[model samples]
Target: MDGDYVIGGVFSFHYYMHTVKHNYTTMPEPLSCAGSINSRGLRFSRAMVFAIEQINNSTKLLPGIKLGYEIYDSCASVSVAVNVAFQLSGGLDPVFNTGDKCSQSGMVLAVVGASGSTRSISMSRIIGPFNIPQRVADVIRRSTAKVVVAFISTGDMKILLEELSRKPSPPRQWIGSESWVTDRDMLRFSFLAGAIGFGIEKSVIPGLRDFLLDLSPSKVADSPLLTMFWEEAFNCRLVKSEATDRSVCDGTEDIKTLRAHTLTHLISTSNH
Candidate 1:
C-alpha cells in the first residue's frame, strides 16, 4: 500500500475430464475410477476467483490495488486459449466483461495453467504472434504462477529448464522453496544456473519444509520417498552438517529480496 500498486492477476485454464484406473494382475481387474470435468472447471474457477478476492481484501502488498483474475476454460481445447488471446488483444466485449471490480477488464492477459510441455508450447506460440505492449508481453512471457506443483518431477523440471534456457532474455529471477528440489532433481538447480547462461539475473530457493513439517510432520512424512528425496536434496547444502531440523538450510532472506523484485516487476508492468 505504501509502495507501488501491485495488480495480482490469476489466469487459469481448465481440464474438462480426467480418467483414472487401477489393475490387479493377480485378480480380475476392474476399471475403478473416472472423474468428469463438467463441474471441475467451474469449481476451480470459483476457487480462483475467491482467492483473488480474499488476497485483495486482506493483503498489504496490494492494499489499494486489487487482485484481478481471468479464468479461461481451455476446456481441454488449445484453440480456445489462442482465440481468447486474439480477442482480448482488441479489448473485451460487453458479454465477456465481468465488470469494474474484476481483473478481466481490458485485454491485458495473464496465463496460469499450461498443464504440460505440449500445452505450454502451444499457448506460448499462440501469444507470440500478437503485438501486445512490452510490459504486457513481458508479464505473459515470464509468468510461472501456474506451475504444476505435482509435476515438478525430475522429468518435468528438466523440460522446463530446457525451455527457459532457450529464451533470449530468460526470466529475471525465479523463486521457490528448496523443498521443491530433490536429489533426482538437482539438475533443476543446475539448470537454473544454466538459465543464467541465457541471462536470468537471479534464482531464489525458499526453504519451506520446516514450516510445513511444523504444521503436519506426520502427514508429510507419510508421503512417498520422492518427497524425502527432494527435501534431502535441497537441504544438503543448507542443513547443518549434523542436525536434522535443517535450520541452516533456510533461505528466507534471499527469497524476500527475490519476491520483492518479482512483485515490483509485476506491479510496474501489470497495467500495461
Candidate 2:
C-alpha cells in the first residue's frame, strides 16, 4: 500500500529458511525460505493492513494525508531482517541522480515489526543511525519454578512445546505473551491446558471476513506467496492433476465453509 508517508514492517512469515551452499568460485544462490508458514505472523500483517485501511478512510485521523506501508517476510532469520531493514532505509542502493524517482519514495517514515527479540534488535541497529523513530525469551525444565512466563513468538514457542511434550514434567502454570496464548494451534498440545495469558480482545471488524474469503486461484496466479497459502488453506492444487499425485482444486470448493471465526487466521486455522 502507498501513501504520503510509508511505514515499514517485517514479520517471520516462514519458520525455516533454506540454507544455500555457496561455492566461492561461483555466484551464490539467493536465500530461499522453505517450511511451514507462520499463521500468527500472517494474521498480524493482515491486521496491520486492515488498520491502515481504516485510518486511511477516517475523516479525522491524519485528515487529507495518506499513509502507506511496505511489509517484508523475514523468514525467521536475523540476516534477512537486517537486509530488509536496509531496504526500508534506502541503504541497499544509493542513487546520486536527482531524477531517480525511487530514491524519494523508498525511505520509510517508521518501521513497525520483526517479531522476535533478536530480529527486532537487528532491525533497530540498521534503522537507528538514520534517526528513524520506532515503536516496539525463555527458559524451562530442570529446576523447581512452578510459574513460567513465556515471552517468545509462536514459532519459537512451538520448539519449546515439542521438546516438553516428549517427556513428562510436573504441572507448571504458564503465563504466555499475546503471541501464543490464544493461538488455536498451541491448544492442541493438551499439556498446555489451564495455561493463562493476555490475548488481543476478540472483536469483529466489519467486512474483514468477507475480505479474507475473497480469494481464488486466479487472484493468486502471479504471487508465489499467495499460491503457497492457497494450496495450504484449501488443500488442493489450482492446476490440472497428473493422475497420480495431489488432487487439483475444483471451482466448486467454497471458502465460506471454513467458518468466519477460523478464517481470520488464514492458512492454518482449519482442517479442510
Candidate 3:
C-alpha cells in the first residue's frame, strides 16, 4: 500500500538474527533473520496493514490523502530494532546515481508496533527526539523460587523460555501477562501447562477473514516477504523449488479449507 504519508511498523517477525562471526576481516554481510516466523508478530503487522487500507478506502477519513507503511522486522533483538529505528527516522541517507534526479524522500508520519517492551524502549530513544508517536524486556534464571511470573511481551518471553528450556529446573508454576498468556506459540511449552492469566477480550472485525484469505500468488509477486509467508502458511513453495524434496505450490490452495488451528486468530479476531 502507498499513500501521501507513510507510517512505520516494527515487529519481531523472526525469533533471531542469523549469527555472523566477524574476524575483523572484510566488511560483514548484511544481517539476515532465522527461526520460524512468529505468528503473533505476523498478526500484529497484518492488522496494521488492514487498518491502513481500510482508512485509505474510506471517503470520510483523510478524504484527500492516502497512508502507506514501511514495516521492519526487529528479529527480537534490541540492536536490530534500534537500527531499524534509525532508518525510519531518516538518519541513514539513501544513495542515488548522479544522473538521476534526486528529491527529498517521504518521511514516516509516525511509527506503530515495536512488539516487545525492550525493543520499544530502545526504538523510542532514537525516534522519540523526532516527535514520532509510537504504539505499544527480560531476565529470570538462577533464582530458587518454585514459581515464575513474566510480564514481558511474547518476543521477550520466547527468549526466556528458550533459556529455561535448556536446563533442568524444578517444575515451576508460571504466571504470564496478557501479552503471552493466550499466545499460541507459548502454548507449545509443556511447562506452562498450569499457567494462568487474562488476555484482552478479542474483537471481531467484519470481513477481516476474507481480507486474509483473498491473498493470491500474483498479488504478492513483488514482495519476497509476503511470498515467504504464503509458503509457510500453506506448506508449499511459490518460487521454483530449490530442493528436490519440496512441493511447489499450485496457487489454487483454498485458505478457507485450512484447519481452524492453522489460523484461528487470523481468521476470527483482531486481537494481538
For model 1 the local lDDT of residue 147 reads 31
Per-residue CA lDDT of model 3 for 154-240, tens digit only, reads 777877777667764567688888888777677777755378887777677876767877777787565666676777778888877
Clashing residue pairs in candidate 3 (N, C-alpha, C atoms within 3 angstroms): none
**What TM-score fits each model?**
0.32, 0.69, 0.81
> What's the ranking of the predictions by TM-score, best on top?
3, 2, 1
Order of the predicted models by lDDT, top scorer first: 3, 2, 1
- Tens digits of per-residue lDDT for model 1 on 1-272? 11122222212223321222425456533211122222223333434444555567676755666545444444343344455455445555454443353433455435555433434565667653232334232453566653323333223344345554565333334443222343234453442422111222344223221222232223333432223332443443332456465654344323122344332322221121
Runs in model 3 with CA error above 4 Å?
Answer: 91-104, 127-147, 168-173, 184-194
Where does model 2 exceed 4 Å of error? 20-28, 58-60, 91-105, 127-146, 161-173, 184-194, 239-250, 259-264, 267-272
Query: How far in Å is the alpha carbon of 74 misplaced in model 3?
Result: 1.1
List, residue by residue over 39-139, the lDDT tens digit for candidate 2.
66776676677678888999999899888877778887766777778788873333111122233445888887887876798788863323243321123
After superposing candidate 1, which stretches have Cα over 4 Å from the reference?
A: 1-37, 94-105, 115-117, 127-272
Top lDDT prediction, candidate number:
3
- Against the correct fold, how does model 2 do in TM-score? 0.69
- Model 2 poorest ten-residue lDDT run: 92-101
lDDT of each: 0.37, 0.69, 0.71
**Top model by TM-score, which number?**
3
